[model samples]
Target: MSDTHAIAFVRNEMLPQAEPPVTQRGLVKWLRENMFSTIPNTIMTLLSLYVIYVLLASVVPWLFNGVWSGDSIRDCRAALDGATGGCFAVIRERWPQLLFGSYPSNLLIRPTMAFFLLLLAAAPVLFSELPRRLLWFTALYPFLAYWLIWGGSIWVPLFTIATILLSWLVFRALESRSFFGAIVAALIVFVVVSIVLGGPVVALLDSIATIRLQPVESRSIGGFLLNFILGTTCLSLSLPLGIALALGRKSDLPFIKGLCVIIIEFVRGVPLITLLFVASVMLGFFLPGGVDFDLIIRVIIMITLFASAYIAEAIRGGLAALPKGQYEAADALGLDYWQAMRLIILPQALKISIPSIVNIALGLFKDTTLVSIISMADILGMTRQRIMNTSEWFGVYWELLGFAALLFFIVCYSISQYSQYLERKLATDHR
Candidate 1:
């Protein structure tokens, strides 16, 4: 070989080979890298493992070998071998009653339609890439769904659709002047065209048909659907009320703060069930005799009040976590107390509060079953109602409790997961 070539080859050989990246090896590598990355992390890892093992031990068999089979309660018990699985048959047989409640047998079609419509509405919300127009579909949705589910006709549909459409148009108008003009023109044309096309004739027929279909009383609705409503209504009503209370507590005015403090502490001090007891028992007597309210609505009010207290405490912690700079900036902009909180402090505070608020919401959702004590026919209440007349205690208990647990688990898990996503999303400084 030539001396120049040899020298070049030697120079290349003299340069060191880059070492390969470190292999992630065994348990120690995992432990060092993950479990004990920090002292707190190590403790959490250990705790998580313990919880996972405990859950697996209780859940695996019930999930795989149990819960899925059979018609009679006896068959379900037999399927569990020595261990008990969930009794799914009770849920299966009573599914319709659970869904529609005392919705007249002939009126089942309406609720079933409403159920399908709900799925339709939810589909777009879950998909991030869904078109804005899909929301317009949703806005017009509640009106149609309510009319079908509730005892009504075209009047309800027309009323609901108009409300939703108006809301959407208003929102759109706020966003764009062109859209505002277009919507106004379109609405006028729609009214004129409907009148010319004999739209009222169809509306009359639809209303007459529904009236002939009879009506289901609100009291009859129970089971899983009722639980959903109870949880949703309570959580929805409570959190907003709680936000107001938290803000009130933090207000500069002594009277507002003191009143908020008193309400929150008093509610927090009592068991939720006791509050519910007062709501169901005493609230009615306080009201004038002629004005009757639904039991569901009253229970909802109690739950909202109870949850608001806890929520206020959670939000207060969040508000406290914010930097002083945010407040100063908000105030310097000449914002009022409400404006400062709404525009500057609350957005940040609410982000910090996602996890705790989720926890409270979960607790409230689960606590809704206690309404059974007040003879409110939520899911647990109906399940108990079914079992009281049955010969099968073991099968029924395992079934109902397991079913309820699964439902609760799904809801809480969903909320926790969504809150985690929200926490991450809100933490971003996209604005």
Candidate 2:
């Protein structure tokens, strides 16, 4: 009787899980969670939809009804026949001027090739998974791009490259003893080599001048090409300069820190336009007589200085955000000042500052439009002065401005997307 009472337990088995409800799955779930999850959100969603609809209603007709084939705004208006439309014919007729400015039609291939090659050169640096060997091309790219865009004697870039390589060799040979001494030695070696070889190099290149592309004057460089040249050059230059400034600001030496502080504060206090104006007009006054500086070079220098100041502040914030434990750990490992900074501190600080750096880069790229104020024929200048002001395309503002905006958006958006990717790739918290 007792055994029978104890033997009444039931067998147990695991139950299979059911699929989520349809309303909690797929696109409907996403919209419910993100767009219409609450009363306020629902109202905002509707308002946003209305705004989008209004924009499309106005812009779609203007875009689709655009006259792609026309000689003038009159032809475009006649084609539209009192309907809303855009005169894209200005873009069609003056596309070359927009892209290359006064760049020779025969030499268009050079810049075209250089532009595509830039994508290749930038790939490895932007994406870490790419082979390190690709960085050789990246290193060679500046000289290649200069030759392509400026169409100078090929020997000039070659000599520059040779000097750089030789200087690097000298630096490496001396770096084990002293970093500062190595740098000084490298500079001396570079100067000596350049001077000794400059004449013979030019003479040799002159003999082969028939094989080279015709040299394009710096003044002939304009349009979007000029903007791109300035943006890329300044962006590349400013990063290292900014890093140096940030580190200098944190240095133990009073002189170094004071100099960095003064530079950053002074530059940050002044508006970028003021600096640009000074570069365009005032900088020449400071130079010796008979020394003529190129306008584009002056602009590049000014933009780089401006960008570096902002970027230095961003980097300094990153450095400050770092935990004391990191520095302690680096010191515990018996690392020297430069080694600790280079290997431990910078990698993490720069990673943290990626977004800020990208912001500075985007702003710098757009600021290239400011070159127009100096009477330089950047894309904005070309569009405003050459394209819109012309009798044939007069009063066609929206299409040309919109096209410029689209181009800038494409480039800026690409930079933003790349920064996001880099952030994800470098994330190590396992979150």
Please name the candidate that would achieve the greatest lDDT relative to the true structure.
2
Q: Candidate 2 residues 1-431, lDDT tens each?
A: 67888887676976789989999999999999999999999999999999999999999999998899999999998999999988898889888999899999899999999999999999999887899999999999999999998886777888799889999999999999998689889999998988788778777877977346689998888899999999999999999999999999999999989999999999999999999999988999999987777889999999999999999999999899899999999999999888999999998899889989999999999999999998999999999888888889989999888888999999999999988888888882332
Clashing pairs in 1: 87-399
Q: lDDT, candidate 2, residue 411? A: 92
C-alpha RMSD values across all candidates: 8.5, 3.7
lDDT for position 270 in model 2: 96
lDDT (Cα, tens digit) per residue for candidate 1, span 58-77: 87766666655566777776
TM-score computed on alpha carbons, candidate 1: 0.69
